[model samples]
Target chain A: MEGVLSGAIGVLAASGIWLVLRPRTFQVIVGLCLLSYAVNLFIFATGRLVLGAPPIMPRGGFIDPTAYADPLPQALVLTAIVISFATTALFLVVLIASRGLTGTDHVDAQEREP
Target chain B: MTPGPEHLIIAPILIPFFAGALMLIYDERQRSAKLAISLGAVMAMLLVGVELLMRSKGSALTGFNDIGFYLLGDRGAPFGIVLVIDRLSAMMLVLTALLALPALIYAAAGWHRQGQHFHSLFQFLLMGLNGAFLTGDLFNLFVFFEVLLAASYGLLLHGGGQLRVRGGLHYIAINLTGSLLFLVGVSMVYAASGTLNMAHLSLMVPMLPEPQRVMLHAGAAIMGLAFLIKAGIWPLSFWLPTAYMAGAAPVAAMFAIMTKVGVYVLLRLALLIFGAGAGASAGFGAEVLIAGGMATVVFGFLGVLASQGLGRMAAHLVLVSSGTVLAATGFVLAGGPVQILAAALFYLLSSTLATSALFLLIEPMGREEGGIAALLALTADAYGLDEREENRQPEVGLAIPGSLTVLGICFAACLIVLAGLPPLSGFIGKLGLLQALVASGSATGPMAWIFVAILILSGFATLTGLVRVGIQTFWASDGAPPRVLALELAPVVGLIGLLVFLTIKADVTLGYMNDTADALLRPSIYAQGVLGAPRAEDASP
Candidate 1:
């Protein structure tokens, strides 16, 4: 599970970087969304990936290290997801408005001249 | 009895919050009432800030527990969120509220009506800034960073010009990237430490095993990078000037403090988590910070010299402020005296005030370009004609054609303060920093000399850019004098007046700043206060 999750994160991050570097604003937005996903996965993996363990405290109400997954990273990641969603929405609104105004997909608001 | 004065820590964050929500219910035409409410909320915040500052200065500010940290609803630490009211955070709250009062008043002079929800956005922005300063956990810091960034976005786009839209897009993009980095950094630190509370992390950072320590350091480095980006430090700061230039004048003024938010976080977190007691990791990135900071100052100077527009020049001046503060903080971290930190904090206040004043002054100064040019031409002719005693243009003019004298005087005050000229707060701040540096006994180093040179040279660069723009806009232009309103002029003049007051009362401010600096250097006290942990150095003292 750790290997698989790490692999997915690596690939997402790589592709996101490539896309974000693209000239089109839409591509950059998509890339940012992808990068955010990669980051989420990265943050999740930082907790030391667990295959079967749930982070819930036992009925006895004591934590045993290396027994269950860490719950703090999960909480942090959840918050990050919500904020990224709102931010992405805001980004898209700006993206559309920018495209309408600039008539170019370039992030700099100017088209490349050859 | 109702949680005592500790509860006031949260009021600065809440007053603006509730007011913002309430303002949303009022329609656009209800300008008078909304303005009144905005003023009341800000004034109330300023009052609370004053109270908090005084209390923090009193005996209550001892040990982290009694002084700064208050778990929300008394939620136990390492789990529930916390609000800290150290001299540092209290000072930040006071500064933010102070800036908000002037900025909001200036906005009401017609900038408020330029949008759908200016008042709400301003209040929300205040809530975010105050909360960011008060938060005691990394996760909550991230949350407030988002909150403030969100509010900044709304406020930036409020006026709805094409330039604003473009700038807003770039601003949002760059900040989102920073936010992403911040999240990743926080999560990594959480994973390494198994906790998100700053106080807890402080206790645990020194004890991390070798490999985890490495990871934590990497995470912190990334997080610090994100903050530097926001702070407009050299390389990551390219987005700041254009975006800020495009911002409405009042928003830009308020944003002068916003950049300091990054500096505040850096100083707060770096000193807290990685100060002397961090065992193996004390002064981990001191060299890099100093180098990067010096580079920022150089770039900022170049930017100031290069900028042609008044707006962009003001924005570059903010960069200069950030660079100077960053480099000075670096010196302190690199084992300079506590006095340097105090001086830097003083410089921080003066520059913030001066920068905000400059941003507010820009509009009125630009407003009269046409009339200013004509006046300049006439004044020049008088000078050229060997003015007889009767033909002298009043060095200080009476009320005529929209008080060019007031605008010019305010403009001059901003220049003197920003340029670190004597007799004003800016000069006093720079003098304090220089005196502290020399007294630190490290003034012999090449780096110290270079830093000194950068400080003095950056001021010169800023003065050149501003004076050039001043000549073009206020003197060279041939247009009619722009109509400056009393509402707008009042805030600009009031902001400069505040700077003058700060100059006059430098000793008291410096004393508080030194206390704040002392608190920062002793992280064990803060850690023990927050987490009730045995002090790492408990055996020594």
Candidate 2:
């Protein structure tokens, strides 16, 4: 499960990097979204996969200290998701402003020197 | 009695957010009210900050528990968010306030005339910068960073000149990438360690596996990259001088404080999370930092040599200073507690003083530019005044206290101090750093020698260029170019006064720095302070 998840994360990262390098403004935004997703997944996988459960600690049941999944990563991911959302919104607003002001969506629209 | 320091930590972030919200409705044209509101908030922050520092210094900040929305709370009360006011963080908050006050004052002086909603954005930026410093949780740090960046976007583009717009775009683009990675890194740390509580992460970081550990390192590296881009370390620093050059002097000064926030976080992570086995061996990003810092210093010197006048030269010098601090901290990290702490503290104090002075200097330098240019132009029209006046512009306009040469000399002396010359705080910092490096026993081989060579070379280069600037501007006989005005002298005097203050209190300040360092080296104290002493069950193997 870890391998597959991290593999998917790798693909997301590559695609994100490629898109980020593109000249289009929208592409950069898309790239940022993709990279964020990849990063979140990568972090999630680092908790050492627990097949039987999400990190909720079972009570009144056998307390297998080893079996209890770590809840910290989940908590961290939740916050990361929210931050990424805000960042995306910020990017959208800035992208629109740049377009309105410069009349171009290309990243290098303002570049003059070769 | 009063709620503990942990709760007070929230005020630094919360007060500004509340005040900034209030400022949004503030009349766009009511410059005075905006100034009052911002200044009022800053003073309040300073007061609260000093209180927190005093409290935290005495003992643990004590974490938060159940207090929902009130500005203050306890450190151990673990629910919504915990704000820990450790010595390291407390010091950073004080530094931020110091930089913020002047930058705001500079802005108040008429910089806003060229921009819109200046106070609103400035307030928001303050909120972000403060929040980043005070946050005890990793995710919250990311949130504050975004807040700060969002505010910066507005300020960077506030004036809307073509050059500014271009620089703003690049600045925003690079940081957005950084933000994305920052999110990822925090998430990874959470996954590996199962906690975003910085203190908890400190305990868990050393226990992770190889592949997982490497991934964590990568996350840290990526996060470091974001900060590096922000801090204006060499290679990644390309955007800094350009963006800074385009902004008004006051805005640039405020932004100078922004990069140090990145450096602060970088230092925090290196000391707290990445100091051990896999993390240390992975080199997470220390080598890059060390190399980049040296490069930044070299690049800054070269830029200064190649540049024409004061403003641009000062901008490049800031980049150099940023690198010097980063490099010094990197070297400091290689040594043990006592030496590293002393060195880091000294360097931080001197760096802040030098950087602050340079920022203030820009305002006068800008004024002088016009005066000096006009003088030279007049001399050309005169055909042949005194040869000195003909060859160099003389004091033409105002009655400056010293010759442009003397003023230039003072500025050069300041830079020499910045580059770590003896008898000044800069030298003390550099000397302490060298001693730490040597004592670390890590300085004997090739890497150490290379690092030393870079330090010495960068030092000499900075001195040579700065002295040359002094000679050209002040020493060279120029027909009296322009008498300096009070406005020009005021900021320079203020900066010099700060330098003098640092010099006089050097022993006391260095003592405090050492104390702070000792506190930082023992992560256990920080952990105990932020998180209630670990449970006996948790300690069980």
Candidate 3:
């Protein structure tokens, strides 16, 4: 479980960082989204791998101690996800607006204008 | 002490949030409704700020529904997402309210003409500003930061001008990048420390292993960069002047407070988390901060020197002020408790006042009669302002009280304050920080002094630029004096009154600043304020 989590996190980080380094605005936005996913997963996995367990215990019987996962990180991840989503939406609109207004998606395009 | 109701902190944040939403349903042209709602929101914020300030001891509000949500410190703790209003935060809220009130009033005068939902956007912006200052949790802090930025995004492009829109895009892009960095940094910190609560992290941080310690510091540096960008520090500060120059005066004034909040957060985190003696190599820390601050100061001054318009110059000054505070932070980091505390407190107060005044002044000075073009032409004709500066934006006569003299005086006073000249809190704050840096035996002592020298020089440059501009507009012989409308003069006068107030009660103000400084240096009060008393024999939370 740790291996899978670490591998996915690594890929996410590498892809996000690579995109972020690009000059395109769309790429940067994509980078941010990827990074956000990696961060969210990283934070969740910090509670340790609990693949078969539900965060909330079943009501029918007293739950096994190791069967339930920590819910705090999940709650936090939920908030982070919502905030990131809003952020991405804002970026998309801004990207479209700027592209329409300035006629460029390349971050350097504005700087290069005489 | 018994926990106060947890809702007090939440009140300041929620009032404007809900009010802003309610504003959207009303007609865009309903000026009266917008004004009343805005007035009510600011008034609520003012009351909450006042309530929080009057208390000597800290209070918290927490609910015990499984996971606790707490608001504690100062007077009473209201339940919900805790809003701890310490002496420092309370004072900031008050200052924010003072600035926002007139800016809002000024916005109302221009709302219809500007063709934006000024009131609704303004309300949400205020909500974000208030929430940013009030939140006890780190994640919530980012939430408020985004809220503020979102509102600013709308407000900046309210007029739909091409230049304004382009400038707004740049501003949004930089801040959005900063926001992502902030998120990454905070989550990394949380993962490393095992707690997201600031108070808990402060305690847990010192015990972390070496590599993790370095990573945490790296996280802090990243977070610092985010705020610094928001604060408009040099290198990352190129977006400020053009962006601000393109905005409506009232919007500019309100946005001025936003940068200060960025510096405020940086200061808060620095003192509370990183500066808690939990990190290795104090020299490295001080050097990094001071150096960044120094570069910021230099660039800001250069920007001021090259600036053509009142708005751009003011934006440059904002950069200088942010840098000044950051530079001063280095000294505060190295200096003894008394010195660090005093300087930090004074810098915060002085910067907030100076920046807000500049914002208020832009409306009157940028108008056609009072506009930078007229001011420049008049100044150039009188003192030979470089005629090569032809690409300047045109200024129109202000819709408000358009007195160039009042505007000149207000702008000059702000310049003086920003430059840390005598008879203003800026001078006192700078003096305190200088005294401390000189006393602290850090290796950066020479560099600190050099930064101080640059600060002084930048102050003079900005002052000269302001005077030159003012002279052209208000004092030039052949220049037609820009007419000052009454509406415009009100904000100018109100800001001046506050400046006078700061001068008159300088000692009391410094005393309060001193207490705030002391509280910052001694993180225990903050720790206790945020986290409930440690259980049993555990020293660290």
**CAPRI quality level assigned to candidate 1 from its DockQ score:** medium
Q: Interface Cα RMSD for all candidates?
A: 1.1, 2.4, 2.4
User: CA shift at A112, candidate 2, in angstroms?
Assistant: 6.2
What shift in Å separates residue B488 of candidate 1 from its native position after superposition?
0.5
Name the best candidate (by DockQ): 1
RMSD of each: 8.1, 8.1, 7.5
> Once superposed on the true structure, which residue ranges of model 3 sit more than 4 Å away at CA?
A1-28, A57-67, A102-114, B1-6, B57-81, B276-284, B335-337, B369-402, B439-444, B477-479, B533-541
List ranges where model 1 is wrong by over 4 Å: A59-65, B1-3, B60-66, B368-402, B533-541
DockQ of each: 0.70, 0.34, 0.37
* C-alpha lDDT of all candidate models, in order: 0.82, 0.68, 0.71
Best first by DockQ, ranked = 1, 3, 2
lDDT of 2: 0.68
Distance from true location, Cα of B207 in model 3, Å: 2.7
The pairs that clash in candidate 1 are B368-B482, B370-B479, B370-B480, B371-B479, B371-B480, B371-B481, B373-B477
**Which consecutive 10 residues in model 1 chain B have the weakest lDDT in total?**
B381-390
lDDT of 2 at B18: 81
